[model samples]
Target: MPIHGIGIDILHVPRLAALIERRGLSKLASRILSPVELDAFCSLTSQSENKRALAANERGPTEPIVRFLGVRWTVKEAAYKALYPLRPTWKELTYTSFDAKKGLKPELVYASLSPDTTPAKLHVSASHDGEHIVATVLVEQG
Candidate 1:
């Protein structure tokens, strides 16, 4: 396999938290995540509703919610970078889906692909510490 490109992104958790604080999760979700990703994020965060209520005050936010949004943000940014040259603008590119096939493993689906090129293979990896979220993407071409 030939390496097409690689991209990596690191995001501060608080930045996303602030955005969510200002824009609200629903609005932010519409901007950044696809319907599938939004659904997954909702489900994941909902699992912690009790904890969310305890952690949340009049302002709405919980750790899981922040991290989930952050991870999605970072991963999408990295994927955009990896698709360099073909660098479609963020508005032109959309993460069509994210499926957690097993455990925490996620597969990315993209919409509005450029006509000239397509990735033969794609790999994504993501991690989050309490403070930051990081994601790396590797693209392969035949």
Candidate 2:
């Protein structure tokens, strides 16, 4: 299937961090996230198993985790933008995972639900340029 929509977004990490701090994860999660999305976010932010695995590598825990979260956040925003033309409701979309098969190459996994449709495939990609994160979302109807 051809892509239904393309979306790109750029975000500043510090700004997003401040928003999350002020509003709390639950609020943000409820507003913009699904159960799978919340799980993915928390896994990057608070999972000890993933943290330990990442820490065992050379880049250490903190920086990698921060970058991972930033990329995930950007992907979420990109996914939202992609779905705007179709679903339009944030509650209908959810991200499942963000995986870096190679450095700076991320694979975003997500699911979208809408009336009259079962679920569609949502793909997201993220990259970092200096202090900003950039993401691209592609939605395909099946």
Candidate 3:
């Protein structure tokens, strides 16, 4: 297969945190996360609700959730670059990985926008350090 396009994106963790601070976590999640991703995000955050003392209005997302949002944002941005003009909506794509012990490799689950987009291969890679997250996407034709 030949490479069709490649894109890379980087984001600062605190930048996303600041955004979430201005616009609630749930609101941000719904705008960026696919339905499956929304469910997963909710499940992850709801775990600590019982232990949290501050009301939802006063609390910001935990570090882990911030990191999660960072990854999603950067990866989606990268994918958008790779698939430019084809333009799959945020809800039309999801991310999945397998075997975290072996270093999970990110995969893009894209609902093809058209018949021409099908049978395409998408390779996604993402990583987050203390204050930054980056993702790269490569698109290939069969």
Per-residue lDDT of candidate 3, residues 45-103 (tens digit): 88656567545766677887788778889988999898776788888879864458988
CA lDDT, every model vs. true structure: 0.70, 0.62, 0.83
How many clashes would you count in candidate 2?
A: 0
List the candidate 2 regions with Cα displacement exceeding 4 Å.
47-69, 96-113
Candidate 1 colliding pairs: none
Question: For candidate 2, lDDT tens digit of each residue in 15-102?
Answer: 7666666776446656665566667656655674454654333343354444555666677678767766554455455444443664
TM-score of decoy 3? 0.88
lDDT of 1 by residue, 38-101 (tens): 6776776667765556443466767777777787788879988886766644444333334567
Best candidate according to lDDT: 3
Residue pairs in clash, model 3: none
TM-score of each: 0.76, 0.61, 0.88
Q: What RMSD does model 2 have?
A: 6.1
Q: Give the residue spans of candidate 3 off by over 4 A.
A: 51-54, 101-104, 113-116
